[model samples]
Target: METDMTKGKPMEIIIRFAIPMFIGNLFQQFYNVVDTIIVGRFVGKEALAAVGSSFAIMTFVTSILIGLSMGASALFSQFFGAKQYEELKKAISTSFIFIFIVSLVLTTITSLFMHQIIHGFQMPMETREYAADYLRFIFAGLIFTGVYNAFSFLLRAVGDSKSPLYFLILSAIINIVLDLVFTVMLNMEVTGVALATFIAQGISAVSCAVYTIKRMNFIKFKRKVILFDKKMFKTVASYSILTAVQQSASSFGMMMVQGLVNTFGATVMAAFATASKIDSFANIPMQDFGNAFSTYVAQNKGAGNIERIREGMRGVSKIIVAFSLGISILVFIFAPQLILIFVKKEAVDVIAVSVYYLRIVCVTYTLLGFLQMFYGFYRGLGEVNVSIILTFVSQVTRVLLAYGLAMTPLGFAGICLAIPIGWFLSDALGVIMYKKIMVEDSV
Candidate 1:
């Protein structure tokens, strides 16, 4: 069902939207975690290292589409909130066309330059082979990823978060079953998991797009009007392209961090990969809530309820602090048990390093949460350049610190420490930027 977020109590409305979104995001992250676990346990630590390395590469490529769709979704919410039905339909059509073109470009580049991309990571030859195998099938499925996000984000923007979750749940189940069949029984190693993901996501993307177009008539259109709005095209492009750059810059920075982690060999690489996923998993609630907050703010902004947007931000921050603190305690206390889920018990070194990395970063999720909310707030308000600038600050700090600290005695420990520091630095900057923007708005 569609919701008008501009009406309800801000916190109540946000939690309702965020609950399903959080679950869906969890399942989405589950795709990668399941791959890591299956690859790590069945294949070996080297393969785990490879999967870890490939994450950065795939995130970089896929983020272009994800970011674009996200930006467009904000616009969707805004238009819907304002009851600009015609503009919403036209923008939807335009964004779908533009996202499709970008997906093709990414698929082409990733296909052609696959080896060079892996080589840049500086992993061992064995790990590179595994990374290459993993990335090949993943790249083949890039178009499906674009289709899925373009539609799912549209659904969320219109306040129908549950439908996307249903689609992800089914596809994620297929992905898990296929992961087992391909990697274990078929002995396909990294190739099996990648192929599983490729097939599973194709199912979700096609299904979601089909359902949304056929069933949701609000944004649907006659075939003739699709892609005809030149002005809306510029609006969609500004939001989508800037957000895409922000997302891509983030993944690109991680790619650099992956290269640095690779320098420490397979053990550290495997540990970082697994630990980072766990870190990502632990902190995903913040991202989901931030997204919900953005949607809330977007709707209110479109309704010209600036005061409600302010209230929504404050309410969302309280939720963030509560979620971040609780998750931090749990993750810190159970770091080893969590690490064991991904790798074998006999892989003592990998487990130890994973624990260390987690312990270092888990406590700082609050800082991460605030920074993420800042990104979402700006993006929702159509100030996507602010998001890009904030992300640039965060990513640059992370990449530079990882490399700089690598030469010191702290070594890999320094790399782990950089994660939270980057968040803190960005959060500080986010505060100042947000305050300035609010003051200007008041003026």
Candidate 2:
């Protein structure tokens, strides 16, 4: 369908597009958070910590696939906007092949190194075993996750965000139900949680792919269409590498932070994991808006409509700022209740530490809001390298800050403080880069 997202008023367009994405993204996080709550309440804190510890490693593997999908979305949106139907079809086909190969290789590599990678994080022995079990199962499911995500990206690129959202909601419900059955009834512990998640994601990915292939006429491929197009593959590969680097840098940095959290012991690790789920939920609005803006800007840019792109940016900025402030207030006020959702009264200190992190980081949400949008903005303009550079700068600095601070008088709180500081710096750099390259080029 790939309708022009830039035609309507920027705010209205963004809201329309973002609402579905927000719901979908929230549901996506719900699967994990709900699993944590169920596990913490039913299984135990160590189990929760184990599942949480594997998060960064899982994210590291998944980021490459996500980056590839984003590249496909960006490329498809541009081609769709230009009304190059045949080229768009070819892009879609090439993307599938590219994702399959990359995901297969990544899955194998991560699976083989799973134990070593968890060990490298230097987590407690109790937590490390659980984390290793979880990672092994999750790594097995990476290919399905990658394929599903690629299709989701393909759908979103063509202005059908609603479909992917529908599938995600279904998958979240499945994951929650399965989590209860596996963990509570079967007493499968962390492995149960991981298996439930993998099954849910697999089902969702299959459902989405089937629906897309059957219903979306544009993506239906002929023999020639299915054949990989060299030019389109090259274009996607070039842009995708930049995105891959950006994501790799970010994930690698988080892995570093995870290492620091591991040093603080299992309780701190569990708390960090719980807090991260809440943080992910809170940032949904801004994150979804950034995604919408990326597609919006890409479509408009392809049409050479600079004014529409600018207007979209302005509208997104206002919405993100308002949303950020609202979330900050809510998080500060409900800190205890939010923390209690995944932690317990005995672990109240862990909750307190998490609340401190969230409260402080809340101040920088608006900055992060703008920063994410600008990253999407440049990506839409096919200026992926700029985004990569900014991500590297920000993530590298965040790691350094967290590592150095955690060793000092500030301790865990110092590590928590690193987030807002990173956001501030990243936003400033993103704005500068956008102006220097994209804005200047437009003028």
- Which has the greatest TM-score? 1
RMSD list, candidates in order:
1.0, 1.4
Best by lDDT: 1
Write down the worst ten-residue block by lDDT for model 1: 434-443
Error of 1 at 75 (Å): 0.9
TM-score for each candidate, following the candidate numbering: 0.98, 0.97
**Candidate 1 lDDT by residue in tens digits, 1-443:** 89899897899999999999999988999778999999999998889999998998888889889999999999999999999999999989999999999899989998999999888779888888888899999999999999999999999999988999999998999999999999999999999999999999999999999999886786657888776578888999888899999999998998899889998999999999999898888868999888998888888889998888888889988999999999999999999999999998999999999999999999888999998899889999988998998899999999999999989999999998888889898899888888888777651
**237, model 1: CA deviation in Å?**
1.3
Residue-level lDDT tens digits of model 2 in 357-380: 788777677877887887888888
How many residue pairs clash in model 1?
0
